[model samples]
Target: MGTINELLVNIEQYRLLGYAAVFLLSFLESLAFVGTVVPGALFVVFAGSLAAKGFFDLGDLFWFAAAGAILGDGVSFRLGRRSTIYFSETNRLFKPSRLARGQEFFARYGGASVLFGRFNGLIRAVVPFVAGVAGMAAGRFYLWNVSGAVAWAASHLVAGYLLGTAWRTVEVWTTRFGALLAALVLVILGVYLLKRFFVRRGRLLLAFAGSLLGSVGEAIITNPDVRTFVAAHPRLCAFLAQRFDRQRFAGLPLTLLGVSFLYVLLLLGGVIEDLLASDPIVAVDTRLDNLLFAFREPTMVKLFLWVSQLGRGTIVVAVALTVCGILALWRRQRYILPFLVTLGGSTATALLGKVAFQRPRPAGVAVYREWSYSFPSGHAVIATALYGFVVYLLWRRTAQWGQRLNIFFAGLVLMLALGFSRLYLGVHFLSDVLGGYLLGLLWLIIGVSFAEWRRAEWGPVSAAVPFRSRAAGAVLLVGLLAFFIRTGMRALPAILPANGAAAATVTVPAAAIAEGLSRNRLPPYTESIAGDKQQPLSLVVAAGNEGALTAALRSGGWLPVEPVSFTTVARAAWQALGGGFPPVAPVAPAFWAGRPNDFGFARPLALAGGKPGREEARFWRTPLRTNGAAVYVGVAERIVGYEWGLFPRLGADLDRARDDLVRSLAGSGVVAVSRKIALSPPMTGETLAGTPFFSDGAAWFVEIRP
Candidate 1:
């Protein structure tokens, strides 16, 4: 087991080779027999740290990790399959505790355990061997195996690469950079994993009480009617406002649940501003005097005018908002998170736009307030986005259309109020408000689309982390990461660039920042049968569950073939990349091949009645026909997209075509798809790089078309 710091430094020194090493090491460690002895955590982080220095190819990471993983476990599985267990009785004498723990972890999390355990410190090696010994289905194992390896490799490498290059100072802040690096590794890995699981539930509700209670609370926050109603009901609004500062009121604990939401909101505002800061077209108007003079007659809102000037108020507001966010999380107010995500996404974008475009604000600007750079109004961006998200989280919970309508209208009212507040105060131009609204709403749309896209894939929420002594510490740590990382200057630039011009003028692009977050930030998908024709396709598969999803293809006459890892397929494809002849990777190769990786992952899928699509496999097809037979199997979110040469037919549906297949599986017999590849990047507009592919819970089996 290599220490993380050594890995990081080595990777930094060597660049891409380091990533390849990491990719190979992580995979083998996870797959190798009793290999959990390998230190996966530190290795991955160091790889990431090295990647951050800008020398690695992130795309190849999937294959590298996957290959390493398969090989590692291949040996273990081979050992278990070939070596009798009786001989292992004596092996226990030298069995390290870590190996035992790895076995225990495997037992605990199920097949997914092998996947997750590989990433969680010293457990990587032993679990895969144990899995191999259990004779776990190779396909399923590979699916998870590939996924785990990809995630592990990407996270550590990218983290180290991006943060290492961009914000290495954070490491310097402490004497023990290694310790800091380790802690950072844990946080980065943890946060990315969490984003995939329960958090992607398409914006859940805030249940301060139960894993279930906050469901409705979420509806309240995102619903426009609620916002409107609360706004209209000054008394109620005032009550909430008054209680906002209260951590606890009466018997009900107004705790950290709401705090997280607020924090996200604040970041969103600032982030949006940052996005908008660079664009000269996006800058806020600086002509303060004329703008303020017009508002003189409106005495009703004068008090807030002074508050806006202090900028201190904005800081306070930002703090309060962050506190609200933490409270929301602690309370299991899951619903708020979607809206928060939208807000965060938009604000960040807006800020990026503002700063990137460097669009100066309208000049001869208003005197009411000394304004900073702004193309779109942060107030406006947040108003439509954050409030809209709030409303979205609120209204979706109720079945009542009337309530939904009410909240929708109310959300509109609140948005208008905020928009009016900004305009009346002469703080933002009409265009600024509109641009903010447009951009902010765009974020909401994207967030909502993402939430909806991932809804089916979202699993049950994790049990909430209890707010204990560590809660504060955890928060402080996160804040330190966010703030210092943001503000943290690196010695890299100073060290590399000559003094005057090069250092100050050339800003390193964000894309230059290590893989730009996890390749798995998005969710994954299962096979979609929507486009499959009802033609009886001959499925050549081995027995067991292999026949379960074979549609009408019967195993009675089917030839038995040895199962292989998907990596075999990936390797073949990688090799075939040199060959121009494309391969139609079947949907759910395991359905036909017994193991998940046995045949073309999508090899078995075709219009059964028609001539075989691939000439190579045409000879294998029998004149078999099953009407309305369907097979659908479900898998987890993973990095499982077919590369272009692998699936030439996968045009618009590459990202979503798999889901279409899943839907088409109603009458199908067996659907043995892999949950692997949930963490890999998307190839095209067919899918974005950020999202992963997760399947619906079940792949409905029905006789359907390919």
Candidate 2:
């Protein structure tokens, strides 16, 4: 590559001579023996790059390279036509076996091989020669040969030209602000157009990609060895055919059936591999978690929180019962079987997987907590099973392919959303969610297969009347409304436990208000709202109001952090990439009152060397008040970069932040009383990053002076 770049640089110095040089190089590159010794392809692309720089005309460069390639292949073809006399039978280049392979390739692809072979490295040299030896007509060779040469020339030249254009643009943007803006605008416009193009031709693009994959798959399936193995194991083939065929009852083709089964197996195998092996999937999951965490904001948090609740025990039960009742009343009673099998099977399987794998959840600061073992996320499992069954039922009743596709994708979106909710909430790892999805899908497939098989034997029954029956439809509508009501009504108390009557309603432990003080070396880590790992609820303020708490932290040299919105996140990411630690970095959410932290504050640390760190605290404004003062609960954590990777850890112990805060407050001459309070039952736990910690369940309570 370096040598090719140097060659291109030298060519740029000589204008007309450079075009001649490209023609010569491309000619030799296309010749039978000479092509193997020359780097013709790179030279052609380089010539194009130079043309883009305005050193030569792109059209002239293309025609010259293409003409060179044509002439080179013409020579190779004539050599092949006279091979018997020009070369010995023992000559390595004209060996019978090598010639036979080329003959076979030419036979398989026909004249089209002459055109397509130009793009392929080794084939470019041999195809023309072999075609001549195989008695291809001169007219036919010339037709494909010229066409292939033109295509090859145009492709490389255009690619190199575009790259050169981009390089020039970047060079200008470095010193010119206006040019930079222009470039950015162009990029945005290009992206918009590309997106529109894909959207308009999405089906065509998908079909093309699918066909390419299908071709490769067909080759593998039809291999002599594979055919022999299948022929010898007829039962195995039959079993796979039945398992994979979605429309087996309707006599779906064996190829389609096998493809469907293979796809499912691929997904299932991937999830299982991540669990059984310390695979790259784990790294991918962590990176995804970090990236998504970067996009945390109040709206998304609320949205996912609500969506995750759809898989909650109450909502799932209601939906399952409503759908089953409607089927039992207005349709065949046997239709209820799919609903039962999906829901029950998924739930049981997920539970068993949890016990069998015993995998722990990813440790992070979070807003929700679950006590169950976290191998396969129960939420992911339930959502896939329940919603998937709904899609199945909708598919059975719907006649239109478009409507069926819509229903299937909607269900898929919901299931994926629920699974993501588990990750965002910090209660499950990527593998766990993937495992749940696979497990749920497996169960749904089985249920649907059974339902389809039974229907095939008994003949199809009409179950489409539920849509026409207002009474049955009403049940589904009301059930859905109940789900909204349950989640909405439950949101505030869980998220925003504000002062006044609501404040008094919270169930604080009797010992919490005990008139005593307890001091431990370590404070108990607040249980993650999403309940993954434990971290210290390091600070509490008994201030006159929210404004007072804000003023106190600000006066103590802590800067208030912006809520995790898009702009703030982008800035933080940009700064982090440059090794600059933003003081107000985004905080992983921890829930109190079922709501995210109301505000975050951080102070930059000064280290003698190495990457700097930040001491950050996140606070929740509770509705509770003490002696006419508003109460705020806060957890503190520190951030430092990983030694090996770009991701930073939020589990850094900054216990000294407590002493520092005390000194800062005392330095301000603001007399405040400090009290130690127990926040949770005593236990030893780890952070999401696997940092082990033991806390005596203590939090600091500071009564601030006005």
Best by TM-score: 2
Q: Model 1: residues >4 Å from true position, as ranges? A: 1-292, 301-340, 362-367, 459-706
- For model 2, residues 457-541, the per-residue Cα lDDT tens digits are 7788864564557576786778678776866567522532112123332322223432221221222344332333356666667
Q: Which 10 successive residues of model 1 have the least lDDT summed?
A: 491-500
Candidate 2 CA-lDDT value: 0.67
RMSD of each predicted structure: 28.4, 16.8
Per-residue accuracy of model 1 over 415-460 as CA lDDT, tens digit each: 6556645654555655566667767776776555445434424543
| Local lDDT at 77 for model 1 | 61
Q: Which runs in model 2 stand beyond 4 Å of their true positions?
A: 1-273, 283-295, 463-468, 491-564, 568-706
TM-score versus the correct structure, for each prediction? 0.24, 0.44
